[model samples]
Target: MASQADRVAEAHKTLYDQGLAVRTDVTGADHVHRSLQNGSSDFARPMQELATEVGWGSIWTRPGLDRKTRSLLNIAMLCALNRMTELAVHVRGAVNNGASEIEIRETLIQVAGYCGLPAGLEGVRVAERVLDAIREQQSGEKSSTAA
Candidate 1:
């Protein structure tokens, strides 16, 4: 019989794999994975395990909504919640999931009406940073390819 720790480890691996596939970017996925793990403290381990298994594996792996739609919804929710850090992360995820810059701008505009101006403006700032980073990455990739 597998030990509880072994089972949990296996579950985390499975979920992380699923998350990576949906997220589609190694750096982003690694950031999420590291964040979920919290730290080396034993007390935090279970929370990390549960977050990975349930949040990433169970909810994110659901079939009803595709990754692109989920990314959009996540951006909206993160904005409403005033989670600027997470909003930045999801902005990258949204782009990876096929959201255009225009789509992101429109979403932020919609957020301004319902979630309020402060939250919407903060989201826009984060989106700009994320988009700029993406553009820089693309530029580097192109330059490397050209060489």
Candidate 2:
């Protein structure tokens, strides 16, 4: 059997390949590692380790689901679970993975109709932030090219 650490490393690598790894600027592997290894009593280490391994590593690593589908699934899950904070992160990730503004807006609109206005509103806010980042990046690229 794979050692526990080896399993975790494999999971991290898988998530990285699928663009689902928590970035250094985001959750960083070190923080995730620490949390998995030595989180508070309320935070079960074994379960957390499994989550980092299987959840982030295996499921996220599969090539079957593209980023767009993953984003949609994340939005639905977030709405269902009332996980707005993580929803926002997924929104940004969706944009980084090439989801168009219209697609995101449509997803949010659908969520609003079914989930509730609050969820939709939060999704919109996240979408706006992601869109702004994309626009800024585009502008920066243009300016750099012209210089």
Candidate 3:
């Protein structure tokens, strides 16, 4: 009984839901929830849906690589592109996906050789900031648990 447009909308929604699950699993639930909240505006909703359905749904769900590899690749690519903000976000994602700090450092080192020194330096700075925040958060949890 659904109209053509309705069916397409439902399909897109399905992809979005799948993407949400995959993204949350990779990035942690709280971060995914906050990102969804920030993209709730009408103007931003389209971009959100596209990123969810396309980037997360299509590419992230592929079987060619594991999540950790994908996260590392993103960090490297973001560093090459000089996308520092996205680099920071993906640094967190890389950590969540089990990438070690050393792996991130190595990736940046590779980037410096290919992407130019300035971009690599900025990427290192951004990655360190995210890593510090994550380290601090983990320390807080450990202290609370100990107390």
Candidate 4:
């Protein structure tokens, strides 16, 4: 069997090469990469490992689905599962993968039809938070440009 560290390193390399970078949501990808590199046993270690191996390596690296489409599927699934927190994380990832707010909104609407109204509503709520933050950042950029 492949060692856990090896799997993580491969996943990290794949993610970097694909240009799918994580934002500064918490500790950042570098911190997680180091922890995975050193084989640390912190509280979130398991999740980090799973993210590297399963989320990044296995699923995200698949060539059949484009990153944007995968992100849309992830958002829909997370919402259906009532995973609000992880949903937010993927929402950010989706935006990084070139998913526009309008696309996300349409996805949420589609999820509503398939996953139920509550699930879709929760997705919209989380997506709105991310969208608002992005809008704020853009407005700040515009104001700074004018100055």
Candidate 5:
């Protein structure tokens, strides 16, 4: 049998591959690649590896909920938890998973009522930034294609 560290390494790779596939499918290859490379410290690297194994491998890969549903749930939960940074990332994920801006707006409104005005406001701000970035990317792509 593999050692604990070895097992974790294998699991992390498997989960990262699976999660990256889903993430890339939703957010596009460029965005997902950029997000995964956001951290570079030794500590950050190990923590990311561990998170990939547990968060993606253990939970996100589980049966029942599809990636779209999971993305929405993640947005809501991150908003409630006051995790703006993660919320921003999931906003992009939500879009990749086929969520419209209107749907995201509605969800934020609902979040405000349940999670408090402050959290809801922050979530909306983060969502706006992510949406803007997506639009910019899309337009850039269109321009490049047209050129």
Candidate 6:
């Protein structure tokens, strides 16, 4: 029989695995590679681990909200908190979660009204950059496949 400690460790591993999957689905394999690789940094290693374990595993995996809703909520909250860097990342995540451009626009509009014009404008700028990258990447994929 597995010991209690063993069981706990196994569960943690399972959640970590699930978190990786969830993150990959939302952020793409490329983003995951850049953000969470073992070679990235030992100093910020614990940050990645905690994000994977607690944020992605515990909160994001919850059934109360779908991934798209969560993505939108993250955008709004990140804007409200003026976390433009994380907001940019989650904007990409929002697209991956199936949020349309108009949906993103509307969310930013609300952010402008509620959060402040500066925050909303900055969020829009970040989101536009992320969306432009997505469009360019998709265009490249389509062109490459046409060859």
> How good is model 4 by TM-score?
0.71
lDDT of 4 by residue, 38-130 (tens): 656676666665566556656666789887888889888899899998788778778878898889999999999998999999899999997
> Lowest lDDT 10-mer window, candidate 6?
31-40
lDDT of each: 0.81, 0.68, 0.90, 0.76, 0.81, 0.90
Estimate the TM-score of every prediction.
0.80, 0.63, 0.92, 0.71, 0.81, 0.91
lDDT of 6 by residue, 109-146 (tens): 99999989998999999999999999999999999999
Q: List model 3 lDDT by residue over 29-97, tens digit each.
A: 887787888999999888888988988988898898999999999999999988887788889999989
Q: Write the per-residue lDDT of candidate 2 for residues 1-147, one digit (tens) a residue.
A: 999999977766665544436332234465455655574456575566556556665665567987567777777677656787667667766665667778778888888888888878877887687678768988999999999
Estimate the overall C-alpha local distance difference test score of candidate 6. Answer: 0.90
How big is the positional error of residue 5 in model 4, measured in Å on the Cα after superposition? 11
- Candidate 5, run of 10 with poorest lDDT: 48-57
Winner on TM-score between 1 and 4 is 1
Give the Å error, residue 69, model 4.
0.4
